[model samples]
Target: MNLLDVRKRSLGVSFNTEGQADIYVWSPIAKKVALVLPDKNKTISLAKEDMGYWHTSTTDIKPGDLYKIVLDDDLERPDPASLAQPEGVHGPSQAIDVNTFKWTDSNWNNIPLEDYILYELHTGTFTPEGTFASMEQKLDYLKELGVNAIEIMPVAQFPGSRNWGYDGVLPFATQNSYGGAEGLQHLVDACHQKGIAVILDVVYNHMGPEGNYLNDFGPYFTDKYNTPWGPALNFDDAGCDGVRKYFTENLLMWFRDFHIDAVRMDAVHAIKDFSATHILREMKMCVNELMQQTGRTHYMIVELDLNDTRFINPLEEQGFGMDAQWVDEFHHALRVTAGGDRNGYYSDFTGLQHLAKAYTDAYVYDGQYSPHRDKIFGIKAENNPGKQFIVFSQNHDQVGNRMLGERTSQLSSFEMQKLMAGAVMVSPFLPMLFMGEEYSEPNPFLYFVSHTDPELAEAVRKGRKAEFAAFHAQGEAPDPMAEDTFNESKLQWELLNQDPHQTMFRYYQTLIRLRKELPALRQLNRKQVEVVPNEEQQTLVLHRWHDNDHVVCVMNFSKTAQQVSLPSYSDSLTKVLDSAAPEWKGPAASPDQADSTSAVTVQPESIIIYTNHA
Candidate 1:
């Protein structure tokens, strides 16, 4: 079944069997709405319907037609739900037949959340060519790296060629620089063929400041609520059903037309909707219905800073019931434990105890008072499954948002990097790796944008500096408008063949493979894991087990070798993995010969793992 077969198509350009196009747009305040066909030099007036939707039918319009809407015949604007804005944000919208692209993977089923080892990459910076075709060429490499899913950063049509893609104005249009709609479809098809699921990042918080035409057409923005970008979207206000329907259909289009397996909703906390059912809940219900009809599993992963478990809780418990959400607490706890600078948000995460808490308890701030925000932060997420929280050591936001955009490879020693990698891959939560993190790519992922408006460009430069000022770094932020900054952020793929980089890359590969092979490690139960933190020695021990099978991880955060007392467990043990092993470019040490009462000597700032021998 296709997108049109599942549910009635909402606000967009849809074609019928006779090649006639039915144009439906919602503009309650506009006294007049007309479709202007530039190629044929014809105009068709749409009659206003009962609920503020303007309707018009025409047989002359077909796929690949270039058209625009005239509001009251006095002003012109592109469609808010445009599929292909080939001419950029200021140009005409292009018609597309969603059913044209043929998919080869008819038997593709969704990857279960427990099996996801996600790899996130920005489309423009992931490769030298930085297009969809270029991204497709690297699928073999990603598959070999043992990542089952690729979480692409937002690729919705934005202002110019270079952007993080959060500033997209036309939500439906694919960026022209990245090969447009056909390009995205090609990447999706290729991913499915390689047995990899694609998770697209989407921004629903606010529209970008540039080329925003939604407000001109109707009451899309509401002054009733304020957001960091602008006024909140009109979700519960008058004529908001149309606004909700526009975004809801957009979500379904990605799944139905593009065959996307999942989506990572960007900053869902900022989507303030006071309706009886929030927008996130509505999206869950809509995707559920779509899944039932098509027999294809579709899921939503949210990026929420609020640390509320309600987002992943079941709907019957008065929660939103999302599939998963990003857990920043894990990053904060792990980063600080690895001797990272304690500044800004990092100020709140202190001591090695937090790391142990993260392993046993789902969140460290479960109802605890936060000194950084001067209030209690987060609720207990213990009831939820471990896979509901996605954890990453290095990601786009963590790297790009930094003052120098330095990755973990730049901040810590090679052994410490291996320790961080071990913690991420071995934990019960879902794991994700930023591009080039497996090989320790040196190039920084700096923030960059290519806005045509000089004023907006200058504002962006100043805004980035002001935003990072609280960190009190020594140097100024990189200029967002500078082409050199964008060039510097691209990954150096050649480093994978070098000495230390190659060793680190192999270490990550081994860890991912072992995690998959070990049944005890694959389980996602918090109760099955035990955290024992020795604060005086600056070391932590995590014991994970399932079905009488057990694995223990001992980590040393201090600068000197320390003897870690093995936890009192009845199972016999043998060393399985070690960060300080000579093969991983670490100091050589013999394997531990110890019972439950004996202690094992660990190298400075390294991790060692042991599995049950019985």
Candidate 2:
């Protein structure tokens, strides 16, 4: 069946072409189901349909009406497929007609995945106001920064106002504090109008702990497997059909209703399904069909710990046809190269060589034995196109998961930050930037939440403390339940006007412009790139070519200056960019030219780029 048919057959309140509302809910176990309107003091009994579905059609209940579903005359709870949780997770769900909003993106076909320069931001911490409307004001700035897409963190309804959005319980509803359904639609419409695509982060492996009422209606989770959060969603177990349909319809809702260009599926490694046809494969097939019908490009980018090529392989090859995935190995290797502590997963990477491997091959471990994992991990993804892997030096998990939530700006020198940026920008893979990384926002991105239950809140606090036990020297992990922690994570926009921050911002803009304009940099072909690593000198040389255009980047991770021989792509090669240039506030004694005839002394912790055609 098509996506619209699936959404109609599944649970949730949907409107017909005539503006008539029809409510369909899956509750095989419940003997009776009734739609309860709390404000109207009315309860309407729903007729039971085939395959354990409860259905009702009504003109009396219109958009903006508050509602709850009662099963077997029990306590009233929000709908499992609520479109808007306007009054928090525990309160009644508000009915929303998605078609009411006027969209102006009729001519906006999404850009290709390879052309995407993604900027990921958390809604609560990106700005002081922390609303969707507030984010719309920053579209001009993002467009100026050369980012074609923005990936918003999860917005599903969770308990209270403050959260990282992973604790969301209502998968279908937009966060009420973020201006609900209308606000998100307006933001998306504005984004499309500005020629920027929107990618929404979504979690489907496991639901959050509190305010999760899916179990009360049906068996949405399974006892067969356990995820890092809790019990895994029932994808391959008994009564899995409803569970799969619910999530599939949720995907369609975001693409069709909200106009999201892509979805970054959170932690696909934690998703366990041993069925013949995996859940991911099924969802991709549905998405493929949807794309054919709509004539718009939509992508599924997964966050996976496993270095498996099967996820991104073609469907005809008996693999899940996902468009792309986030490669944490690239970040880990890049972080270690930039002098990050050798703790946790950072232990597996050994600076320059691993970073070089990440440039040529997407996965650094590529069938090698990892000391941190204590086993042989990952297969080679050398054949995969660079566009399939998204690389970033700093992301939410990399920065926030730290004990003090130290960003690269906090740990590394200014020169090192520029070096890292050049390394990522020069690579063949798609690059992403964190919210405030452009100007190096110094504020820590700490983990924070605002759960109503005191016991659950305390458990979250204790869990955060216990997570950092491996890094023994800390006084205490920041209290995740504290309002101050959330406040501290907000970006300092004023930093862009400051001295070094302004220089860094301009440097990033230049790099992005080069990445977009340079033919060698714009092409994301893995076969066209070559990496030469010097472990002795702690330096990496990357060479990329597209037809007659050639670009070479020299990166030095060492604390001391190093003499490097320049690659002779052509005699007419010109030095395009240098981190040590006087305008970048670098050391006075820096190499002025990169000539193939003689070795040049590169400044410590810096990068220089040379191109034949620029």
Q: Candidate 1, TM-score vs. the true structure?
A: 0.97
Q: lDDT by residue for model 1 over 521-556, one digit each (tens)?
A: 888888899888888888998888888878888899
Q: Give a tens-digit lDDT track for model 2, residues 310-420.
A: 998989988898899999999999988888888878999898888988998899988999999999999988667889999999999999988898888998889999999
Q: 502 in model 1: Cα distance from truth in Å?
A: 1.1
Instruction: Find the candidate with the highest TM-score and give its number.
Output: 2
Candidate 2 contains a number of clashing pairs equal to 0
User: Which one wins on lDDT?
Assistant: 2
Predict model 1's lDDT versus the native.
0.87
